[model samples]
Target: MRLSMPWFVRLAVIVVFATGLQAAPAPALAGSDQPPGMIAAVVARVRDSVMRIVVVHPPEAPPGEKTMAKAGEGHPVTRIGSGFVIDPDGLVATNRHVVENATAIFVATPDGGRFRAEIVGMPHKADIALLRIHTGYKLPAIKWGNSDALRPGDTVIAIGSPFGFDNTVTAGIVSSVNRDIMETPFDDYIQTDAAINHGNSGGPLFNINGEVVGMNSVLYAPGTYSGSVGLGFAIPSNDLRFVLSRLEEYGQVRAGMLPFRTQSVTAMMAEAIGSPAPGGALIAALGPRGDEMNGLIQPGDVIRTFNGEVVTDPRDLARKAARAPIGSTVRLGICRSGTIMAVNVPILAYDPHPQPIQEPGPPPKMLGLQFSAAEGSDGTIRGVAVSAIDPTGSAADSGLQTGDIILRVQQQPISTPEQARAALQARAAAKQPYAAVLVERNEKRTWIPVALPGE
Candidate 1:
């Protein structure tokens, strides 16, 4: 017969098992239980100070019509983007493209009040601009977070107008730091996937603590009508702050610029340039003449370092070069003609004169045709020769090619780059949908259609 256990013993065993299970702690909550961190508090404190900007645009003139206004004059145009208040006096920061040609700029606050704003200054090379709004109302201003402290995978929040939706919040992680996708002199961009869009330009990208770390800018994609494909870029707060301080002090951006045009090299191309291994940066060209006459450096030189930063590629060199202060002597480790050497070059302040990034008066919308002035020689083609065409640009789609000299635009003699701009302006005023340019490629001249920006 089995021995019967006492009822008290049985109860004791059950109690011991139950006590062991209860000793295990419940799962901790997702957020810190005590309180939101200082960072979160910081972010919440500045959310309302941001603004959505709306600008009015002027209609384009007709073709063959003398400009009612002089060349390089302003026309009214409508633009929409986002910005954040930076001062109690209503200073705001935004992207240059947002107010590039604004006749009038207005900012609408989250509280539904609107105020007129003035463009304080703009830096074309840096792609940054500053504006001031005199609302006479106290507005919240955001505190800037240090961009140097940012790391990949850090949580970030982007608040902006996406597709005209105001104050939309999208969360994401910092995809990258110090990205140099564009050829801008100052190109330290913060890559994120925070759902940026058409109306998001100039808006702030915040860290979890809500401090502004970057200014949302471009999307990496083709075509005018496209959505974010998880690739969005921002101007780091470090750079934005630098530009802002300079603008407030100098009324323009004053930064160092190298006198050279560079092309990024891949591993394969690095080898072609005679790099010891398949990894390094190369100088593609010196500046377009005047500035290049200084002749401190030459093309085909492999740059190993700049200003103490390791230069892995052309972009790295550009990023470091741009960040160096103007009037400073920058140390460069260069490899030329299979020989390594060190040189110090004085960096110049960024050229403030807006040299047309593209050919001046070239149609706003690029057809992707690049033309150059002809040389002084008989039997040489004259006028605007299509030296290169962008495969993805409108001209490439239209079958334009290299060595093609454009003689006429819309039946107007296109003798020079200035003439080309005038012809395009006239055609645009005429309400002509497109301007036909006469081109000579391979000694055969024919007419090609060029599209204007607003058309």
Candidate 2:
């Protein structure tokens, strides 16, 4: 049986939303004092807007088949996340990861009504997804806050479905701000002590004034199914609001990208190179036959700024550049070969669908690691092999080198990138926070532990 929210939650919602302020004061519990009145009021006003999202993926058919088996196909697979109403027209905002590949999405409000949703737009790299529900009724819209004004130690509230518990509220202080957690290339997250769990993914994080400040998205945990540990992160409303506006206007996000990979240079490396790094990004390499060759950026260069924003770290550069509009010429400040130079870069929109190939192709470079197919008649494994190495990639940092074949991930054997993705999904469903990939490098074996994206 489906359980409804407790009566107390509804009453609290009425008291706070109706008065728009804290109640006079609660009677002291025999010789004990109650918590702050303002904190309690904020939670009540925001809780009702938080929702539970139950996403269903279409079932699979036999290999090489396009349709589902009429009788043999199992029930539609479902995953639970969270979301909130963004506009009065029934428009809702959620994490792209939540609705990606969902065949059916159900948004359940605190009032106990569930409505079907249609995905309007989603930018995978930005990790933002927008959905619309045909509710045919007026909805409560949240006031967006200025994320730029946020500071460390600010009190915040997270509202969402935790373990399928709809409208669960958790309060905490902003542990930090402007943290460059590498979960997303454009990640400039607001770190909070709020408890964000598996089902908390698309929920709203509110400031004390009842405005939506950020979106609860990720947490640092040992495994997926683990509960809150006081270290959770949210995508700031400032960036998300920008993406939301673009999505509403263009039906997609147009972000600029340089065909290059970079990292922050340490003080020691900067001293050795005689460059005043001051912790800016160092250009490592460029994409092959891509826009980068158009004289945008080069290797052994220190990037100082992107479009006038100081690039204090590699993540900062990536984040600022990613938010730029596509087709716009962005100015970049760099120190190349001991000479400070400036270059104009054109931003381009990346394609959601990669070109399809019938037969297996050469290796692909991701996060700086180079991979190719394994040799032998191993029918179980089939993918572009890893033949090279990126000494700066997470794989390389985890001790992966040349001649390594990625055989299994999280203990599940994989023959292709698709299979590896499936293994990762399985681990995610089980609430496994991190994954370890077992690789065969140089005819030997070892494990490369990588944190899953957006976790």
Candidate 3:
């Protein structure tokens, strides 16, 4: 007996057969044109290492209460996210926002086994966090790939639990690299078209070689919609490796501060400064208490390199500075008056809270500027107000006007002329070339590089 099939059904069958044949070609003896099963093999290799993290948060306290209720006592709030094992000893990495304020964390494996996790360390500046789970045995871990070597259009796979669905796999190409989403100061995200969603936070972004290259962290959604629009961002594995190293050594990440504010060099500013290209970071303002006393880096100077690494812009300088060892000295390549010069500056540990400056005694007459305590409208001391300027002195040449208020010298507040003189004398005693002065003019604050006069 003969049977007839519908035209649409026959077409669908033919398409399916052709796709299957393309996906999995028959085994050939020699010199056959057949595609390798790369994606399938990659998924099989790394899917078992991905984990679903469930966090139980402590209950909120009553209004106006000083303390929160203890964990496991109040109503439980649960949060779910994804993570991956990075070490065989059960070291897992995830987003800090995932386990933030979590009283208890649980990790679920692919084989229906659950284990308790302990928070190892979480860096404040970066969104990465490390956790340790005691599985009582060695767990499968993923190998790290070089995110810096990734080019646009490289094949990548994302494995995570999207919306509580476990082990969801998606594949796409790298859309871009070194993307700054403006979410954090250290934003060097690897942009991909991988399908990442709410529960996919902290999942592993894998390369074609089954190596972890990035950590899926965020996605861009259109207005009023909370789904991925093919714009997914992952924290590059290179930055994550740095954070992990710091966490292992110090239990927290410690970044070195350059003690200065910088702005991206524009084409107009570059021309004004006689720079051939607009790629360096321009020194906009010196920190109130930075290492600018050596006169190495100054206002109007452009930074082109840090420790022999080329600085493309302000963010590059910041990233390089933050990675440097605290209290260690590094050389900075700077451009001044169209001349390239190198200056060695010591990196200082970042201080979130700085001490307030106190008033000093009588003023010295060495410098050619007169300073007095200025008062606000309510009669409060504002700063050391500049009363006079010597026209032929370095202060006047550096654009110090009479009405400008001397707020700080070398980043320390100056309440009296004596303090300003002392700072200047210290710089001179150290044989420093210039002193960074913070001046308030017309309700705006600016940093001026004043050349110290020879004794």
Leading candidate by lDDT: 3
Name the lDDT of candidate 3.
Answer: 0.73
Poorest 10 consecutive residues of model 1 by lDDT? 8-17
Sort every candidate by lDDT, greatest first: 3, 2, 1
Distance from true position, residue 114, model 2, in Å?
1.9
| lDDT (Cα atoms) of all candidates against the true structure | 0.66, 0.66, 0.73
Cα-lDDT of candidate 1: 0.66
Model 3, 169-194: lDDT tens per residue?
Answer: 88778889988766654567899887
- TM-score, each model? 0.61, 0.65, 0.67
Q: What is the lDDT of candidate 2?
A: 0.66
Q: Best candidate per TM-score, number?
A: 3
Error of 1 at 285 (Å): 2.8
**Superposed Cα deviation of residue 208, candidate 1 (Å):** 1.6
State the lDDT of candidate 2 residue by residue for 1-455, as single tens digits.
01022210100010111234232221222112224577678777767677778665444556897754132233334577889888878889987777775545667778866666777777656666888777778788888999888887677878887667678777777888887655555667898877666678888999878899998877766543345567788889988898898778877766556666787778887876656766778888876535544866778888887877888888777767667765778888888777788988776555435222111111112233444556667664444355643322222223344556788887677776567556756765665434687877655778776433222
Write one digit per residue (lDDT tens) for candidate 1, span 239-337: 788789878787776666777676656777766766665445677777654253356688888777786667776666665666688778888877787
Which stretches in model 2 have alpha-carbon errors above 4 Å?
A: 1-35, 58-73, 223-225, 289-293, 352-455
Best of the two (2, 3) by lDDT: 3
